[model samples]
Target chain A: MRSFLSSRWGKLAIGVVLVGFAAMLPLLNIHIPGVLPGPTYTPGALSVLAYAMLIAALALSYHLIFGVAGMLSFGHAMFFAAGAYGLGILLNLLAPSGMPPEAVFLVAIVLTLVVALVLGNLVGALALRVTGISFAMVTLAFAQAANVMIRRNTGDLTGGEEGVRLEASLVPEALVGVVNTRNLYWLALGILVLVYLACVWIERSRLGHVVAAARENELRVTVLGLRPYTVRLFVFGAAAVLAAVAGIGFMLLQSSATPRISTADFTLTLLVIVVLGGVGYRWGAIVGGIVYTILDQRLAELASSSWIAELPPVLHIPLSEPLFILGMLFVLVVMFAPGGIVGISHRLTKGRGGKKDAAEPAVLQDLEA
Target chain B: MSTVLLLLITGVGLGALYFLVASGLSLIYGLMGVLNFAHGSFLTLSGFLGWEVGRRVGDGTWLGLVVGMLVGLVAGALVAAITELVFIRRLYNRHIEQVLVTVGLGLASVALFEGIWGSDPIQISVPGWLRETTEILGSHIPNDRWLLIGAAVVVLALIVLFLQRTSYGLVIRAGVENRTMVTALGIDVRRAFTIVFAIGGAAAGLGGVLASVYFGTVSAHQGTSLLIYAFIVTVIGGLGSLSGAAIASVLVAVIQQFANYYWGIGDLAIVLALAVVVLVRPTGLMGKVKH
Candidate 1:
């Protein structure tokens, strides 16, 4: 048992079990139906699932910078928004008629990747010079600049204050065949799983170790002859690509993109999700994503009910009440559950083995100390 | 040329309002390192209070302003107390937690405000004496705009006196510079924080009244939107520097007005200008660089 627990294959097996359970979640929902009966099987449910998946991807990408890389980026939404708009513009130009829509989608994804890389490089180069809060503010400046540029040049392509819409050319044929909503959901879920696995793989690799080490102590990493800036730039670019991919996925789900999508609200939402899920934990992102999605959807549903509608106009709040609730959740999490769901889970599990390891020195003691 | 003059005057007037809002934010941050994201919402709340008072007692603009300021004082103290007891007290040295908690508070305040007031913008007309436009450099500028500028100057003088001329203000400044030393000297740091917060709140309330009169309307969501501009001013002026905030507010107002005239893009141009300033000067116009 001890040997199995220590082995990498054992960990891989556990991961496989987790993924298998996730894959069968829809089946499980069917078995226990009508518990929360608002379109769990329909195309609408699939669309919501797709959105949740996209949020998961975005949250995971945020974790890469904030969790693994130890850089708090207050403006990562800019890159995501930029990628979506880039794709929107590309699909508009291509206008795939009778040709496979996947081809156009792929083209858009590639374009978004390129854009993300360039943005990541430029911003990383400038921001890496400073650390901590300044880094966050610099990134915010970039995002604000992107938002302004898009809003100002509205006549050219952004659809101005009205926002840009997705033409029919971007929707794939495969998506059309199996309920476009289902296909989108599956696509987003598949991408999310793939990205999560990629992140886990990276976390176990030599590059991940270097990055983790750099985050722990940049000066120490520098003394060890590692170029912290190069490592940061690469990780930043990779994370940007993940965020961009999520953006494309969001476009697929929403069928449109607006400058408002990159606003402070979205940024804060992502931050809350990350923090609520436990900042640096891997599985925490997925857990956080699911919780946030459920909470958001439920609150939105409640806010739009007939009873709410019947209330006097003075007392009735708008769709943003969900955001308010989410914000409150964030504050509570920061105050009481700093470790987040995953962190709390770890603590609980670790408690079981406490007596056995009580006498032993802590792992990562040098770093923690 | 007349258009330019109009834009400039309007910009200056708007800048005066920005100064009022940003000064409160600056003082709060300066004293306690608490980046009160809810500052703008406090302004909105004060406006609501003023509007309610104006509606109740007709032709009482000055009275409304006074009521707003008093309400602001109470609101600020209450919020600061709650936050200190509930959140800020725990995260005294933790900057990230401080930011997150304040942001959450800001969001909750918006929700509460919206729940009470709904989404529609509320119009608040100034009294007759303040409504008429006076000729200024061949242009008809509203007396309300002049009043805003004058009020900002007066507030600035009062704040300066309070901070520089009074013992309590000296203690507050000393706390900002060295909290540990002040605590060591047997001063109640928490009490000092409460006073600073109340003062900041009052300033925001005053700004909110000006905003209601100038815009001729108030909305529950105004705080969130206006927050972006105030944040820009705070950043460009240098975080935690009142003088820097004052200067940055004027700069932002003038630039924003010019952008509105030339660029014709409502909020985008000003946002871009602010971004440019941050890029050029990360520490702000007068912010001390941390080495």
Candidate 2:
């Protein structure tokens, strides 16, 4: 624990205070004084915050594998879906309604973790066998096939194209009760904070350094007389479990898990979040998640109904198709801001270029087009 | 005996579609050295355009079929050029970015396809003569299936011939082996790469049109699905190896048919086979050992 908070004590302290504020957000308000009538702390905002926090937590777990371990996986949705459906099935089949919600959640989480262990180890073992582009493509095939399998034939187990509704008894009442909004917010924010700190510790640990080195050059690690695969596989398995836990938070917040859970688009969403913030950086995932969710949600509203919809075609660019805008954003970020928002700021803080950051792969400048 | 013959034809016919799509994918990967995640987008888009042209001229006419296919081929080639010039050409070595940008392009294109065509799978028809069935052994088989088989054989041969006989083909083969050496030789390797990409697009367009007619409908999501099969074939065949892709596609198709016939597993068998292949041969079944 001391080592976990060893050097980042001040930052950790501030983060805890901020979480406290978030937990008490319903009682707090932000006033613009002249134009605004009240604090924007509405019930809707709580749900959005909870959702964003869960997503950000999930994104952080992805950062552990992709950013830290340099393993690009397209099958993360598999883990997410498994965690969600695992909980739903446990509640529906094994647990009685008379069981305590807390006990049910604990059992469900344990079950989900077991599933994650088996899956994470299996996938890590398989995925670690390939490197670079083939790695991404192979994982993609696995996930896509899984998506097809679960959606059409396994309706009895998965609810098929229509997802199974999570039982009310599965989630702790404090997390889902009508009047327990504050408690839900506290739990979500708390989990987000814990997951964030845990990821930060992972990044700072010796294993984290080893994973980073392996990510940069597996051959180098081999030359150094260390096995890169074993180190990366360990990270992969742990990160998969964390991601599964985040999925449980997502299910608890939404009160249901749909077949949409397994879609590649969801994994893409996580990818966009990680890239939008910055890969490998500690805090980028959370920032990226909040920014992405708000942008996605608001852009849709502005395009369809808000006064922003009445704007000229020029301004309505992203607001038009929205997905076109998101796609374009991804391209532009990758092209110009390869380090994303965090890396850009980090670079600006230093001198120009700053030795190109070892974590960054071959730059787009090689294109020379 | 008839059942066996039917399965064989079925497997071969399926393999031909996989060949048409995967061959282009292999060529693109071979010559360009970039994974075109949007290859299926071209397939889907071209198939839809072809179907539209065919529908206007009435079903199953030679003129309509030719016009439709031509439309698909031209559009596919154009898209490939634009895709290369606008995006891919600029991001050569940064593969993760390549995956993201191409995936984004593919997704946005799928949305555009859905917007234009709606979610409905558009019905397409083959020419009357092509639709007729002939008895082979004891089972009746569609004449178009034979046409598909013949087309596959011809395409494969033409590809080999072009590579072996044409100066452009030699340049491509050399470029695949060593891009730098080929460029140093004053071959304008990038231009060669562009042509190869356009050819890939054209081939995928051909596959798209054939798939539309063969499957009798074209859906927006088929691009991603077909792309997966193409990826599977290309990967298993050894990326950029024409012969490898050809052999692997047929093997995968036979496996798919067997699994579906016996266990009703359909595509799952392909995924499982791929998993097994990756475990045993990480580079793929026919993939050249990389240094």
Candidate 3:
């Protein structure tokens, strides 16, 4: 029974349920039969769903490094930004002609992967030398360096502070039109599903066990006659590429790459998402992503909307800033709900017959043993 | 020769700021194994506060410098106390939770500064004596670097003296080596932590005042950037080693100055320092080898 619950089918079943709900969210505005009104859908809601998916995909990639491998990086933004700006640079350089949007995307992705591969190898090599807090700080330092280089040196390619706009003509008509954003919505959804499955597979794999072992104690892993550095190097490179893949989706969703993508604040946002969802939980990424997007959208609305804007100065000082509110939420959630919503639910179901196997992530369970 | 000398002075001066930033961080790590991610926010907050104080004391007297430093230290100490008492003390063994909390606080503080300061950079002017240039090796350079270097060294020396010469310092050193033993000795470890945090805060505030004065401007958002530098220096200096921080700061600054001179890119120098320190000497130059 336990084996079956941990099997591929079980995970896939979970995925299907989630995807179904996600797909249905924007299509299910209705009246509950003679009782009450149901969810109201909007294109705006669809777009937000799309964004949440991208954030989930990105957060999952971070989980592989931070949660699975125990490497807390303060600069995951570098890879995300790399993936994003890599495409923008390529499209701009190869302008006025393209075989097709598909071809351009493929070629650009290939280039970005190569860039991700090299940068990942370099950063991972340096970063892997230090462990714990030092490693986190080093990643941040490199990230800042990357941000500066992108902002100052690549003015022609990146548009400096002004930010570079991806030329729309670079992609095919069906894939990207200013008004018709359904293509992006579909693209983000499909890619998010695929990447999510990849994350699940990683969590259940032997390599995942090895990564988990390394996270717990490298010296112990070494005594067991396994090469920990090779494991760290491989996971780091894969995580970097995975983050870049999400970055590609991000650029496509926005149809442009900006300096904002590379900021440390963005990485902090990703960290908050993972921590707030469920640090090691496979599906926590999606849950956290949605929660973050909704809170972000609502708070930002409250801060900028007419009522708050018109409030008196003394009364208006504290509550109107969306970022301040988000920051407070981050602190509250991490402090109060460290296990995230998933963990909270698990606690609530303590009295009932709980799905124990599903609750414990495979990697974490192995590490514990 | 003069250019090299001047560059060396500037590097040392730049490094002094790094030292100040890393002092509180290193001390915190030494006594308690927590890395304050919001250390730079303390610096930023203090810088803005110090700038306002300096502005108020527009007489350009030594009193202005004294007031600015005092204001920065007090504000930084207050904020640090709140953070330690209200937030950090609760999560003692959980380093990862502390990271997230501090990072959140870091962002919140930056946003708060933005709300108050309105995204504009504030300019700072030092006393005339501090700003006056002097001829050194036939090169004319402002005395601001000297003041920065002087102030940083003095603060670091005072901290070393306090730790070495005082009972509290002895307790902190003992605590760093083994907290259990320190706790067994009945030295309320938590209160000691608060004191350390306050000291760290004051040091960060001092860094803010010195940094803004050296750069001639302070921005609400500079904390995030400065935090990166301080973290790197602390890591490369080997966690909890004050001397390591000072040396690493100078090494980082000199490399940056040289990198700028040759490649017209200074940030790359710091990146290179990180790479070298990580790959070649992960324990840092002065750091003892440890697991």
- Each candidate structure's count of clashing pairs: 0, 0, 0
The numbered model that scores best in DockQ is 3
Q: How close is candidate 1 to the true structure, as a TM-score?
A: 0.88
Residue A183's C-alpha lDDT in candidate 1?
A: 64
Candidate 1 CAPRI classification by DockQ:
acceptable
lDDT by residue for model 1 over A1-369, one digit each (tens)?
645854789878887787676555554444223223344566655566667778888899888887788776777898788777878877887774555777877776787789888888877777766566546656776677677767765548876556667775466666543365666777788879877977887778888888888877778999999988888887888888788888887777787788887776677777788888887777678788877886788787788778878877655664437777777778988777776787677677677662232221111112211
- Tens digit of lDDT per residue, candidate 2, span B1-291? 887777778788889989988888888777665778788888998999888887797667888887888888888888887887788777865556776778778866776676567778876677887777788898877777776677789889988999899999999988877777888878788777778878788878878888887888899877777788878887788887888889998889888888889888878889888888888887776676242
Q: In model 1 chain B, where is the ten-residue run with the lowest total lDDT?
A: B72-81
Candidate 3 error regions (>4 Å):
A1-11, A24-43, A96-102, A309-315, A357-369, B59-61, B129-131, B184-186, B289-291
Q: Which is better, 1 or 2, measured by lDDT? A: 2
TM-score-superior candidate, 1 or 3: 3
Can you write out model 3's per-residue Cα lDDT over A1-369, one digit (the tens) per residue? 545645779867766887777666555774332211223254455566677778888888888887888788888999989998998888777664646767776787799889998998889888877777778878888888889888884546777887767667766677675444556667778878877777777768888888887777777899999987788778888888888888888888787777787888889988888877877775677788778877787766667668886888654644666677778787997778776777777667654655553343332222211
**Model 3 clash pairs?**
none
Candidate 1: clashing pairs of residues: none
Per-model TM values vs. the true structure: 0.88, 0.90, 0.91
Q: How much lDDT does candidate 3 score? A: 0.79
Fraction of the true interface contacts (Cα pairs closer than 8 Å across chains) found in each model: 0.32, 0.42, 0.61
Interface RMSD of each: 5.8, 4.7, 4.2
Sorted into a CAPRI-style docking class, model 3 comes out as: medium
